[model samples]
Target: MSPQKWDENHPARILLLKEMNEGRIPLDSNEMGPAEVYYKYHSTVEFQVEGMEYNSTFTSRLRRLREQIRRDQGKPEKATKTKTARKKKDVSLTWNENHPARILLYKEIAEGRIPLDEKEMGPAEVWCTYHDTLEFQMDGVEFNDNFATRLSSLRAIVKRDQGRAANDRKALEKAMKNHPVQELNHRGEPQWNGSLAQALLQQDMAEGKHETMRPSELWEARPEYKEAFSRKDDFRWKIRQEIRTKKYLYTLEYRAEEKLRKNLKKEGIVLPDQDEDLDGVMDLEEMEDT
Candidate 1:
């Protein structure tokens, strides 16, 4: 691990933005894989962030790194959702960036052109504002309000995932507690804490319930093992499915918490204990401060 060598205009991040703009890297979870960008491009900046590897460093901090670059330049955080404050601090998205409509929407909101509670605005409105409703392509995809919405969702997921992974422990703990299967060894014998719990669970799913089993007898066990046996040749898919499920559940919980906070705020009840990031994104590190 080394200290971060990044400032507002670090070449590492500049290269990343270049890669992002060039379509070499994608924002969708569906596109995650062993990309050339991960190996070739990521190496250029892997030394900047401490302990983060070339493969994971960028995807893990997709949104935050950009925001960090902005902050390092002495720019203010994102604009306020509050109409009154928004007037004082006109926020903006990068005009030359891929997601220009999002900036336009925020600017519109800041200018009081749209109500805070306004229903979803159409993508056509974005096209109309920018190009007289002319259809266009951006990053090889049709540019419309739907793309804007997807951009927001992807950004949200990136931000949420980039936050401390520990913040998601509640969901993991719930799974471990509520799971019908208990810890078991490869042989199916029960093992206590300090063992490889995940491997044990996979084995349990493979063999079903068994009071007594041995690692040597694994092949002779039942064929209906749901976890390990079913996905024997598809370990990658299993891991991806588990990761996606975990992220989805964690995101649902985060959204619910956001809703509760908003409702409480209307009643003049600010939960000081749950101060989100200045940008209104809840970084797990920030959440744990209180």
Candidate 2:
């Protein structure tokens, strides 16, 4: 009947009345109650709104908001399901035997892809220890000579777990591949024919010279020879020989010797017979005669 001012609360009602005057309202609502009028006007307001794109966009946004709420509530359930699936996968792939590669193989078996015999898996503790050992050796901060041996052992264990013949020979070969072949003489003693021998000979010659010369005369006449003679024991033929030979000896023996020395000193025992009588120890004449 009259134009209305734009009131935010009654915009929809105002729009409904305008549409009705324009003959666009879906139904005649003059007979409706106040509450019924509001409902009917609201429905007509929505219907009269132009553009399908705007309506579709609003519907889509509402749907997205509902999905976000559902996802938030379902997070724990989804996470639990995921964790269970991972655990099942791990169980299927684990190895059972006490092989060197048992830990790695067990992991593979847990995946269910590698079929392993139930009897083959050793004690769980042993498997765990072996796994830890391999991990330590492979990932240690400092590399050691024992790494090759440990790796070889791991490969052998893996082969055993798989029911395959252990390739120890190949493993050993591979392990030793990177190690330098120690240069040794005919008697398996390290070669000492370089500067070591020269240093020894020079000292011996200087010592022989010093035996016949006075200290003052020696110092004044040949200062260099005096200096060399002073270092005689430090560059002795016997000590050089020991160094060359000891290089090829078992490392455990050297460690044991050091430990013994340390323990002896700790117990206040002086190490007896520190020096060897070379002439008595090695009878060169007898060897020559023989």
TM-score of 2: 0.15
* lDDT of every model, 2 decimals: 0.45, 0.39
Compute the lDDT for candidate 1. 0.45
Residues 1-290 of candidate 2 have per-residue lDDT tens digits of 34333243345434544544454532322222122223334344443443312222433433343344446545322323355334533442221232224344445554533334434543342334443322222112123344334334544555575553346666767877976455664545444445344454446444664446443443445444334334444334444344334333434344444454443332222233354333323233533433
Tens-digit lDDT track for model 1 on 106-174? 445545463333245444554445441101211223465655664455445444554545667877888
Off by over 4 Å in 2: 1-125, 131-238, 247-290
- Model 1 clashing residue pairs (backbone): 123-145, 187-214, 187-215, 205-226, 206-225
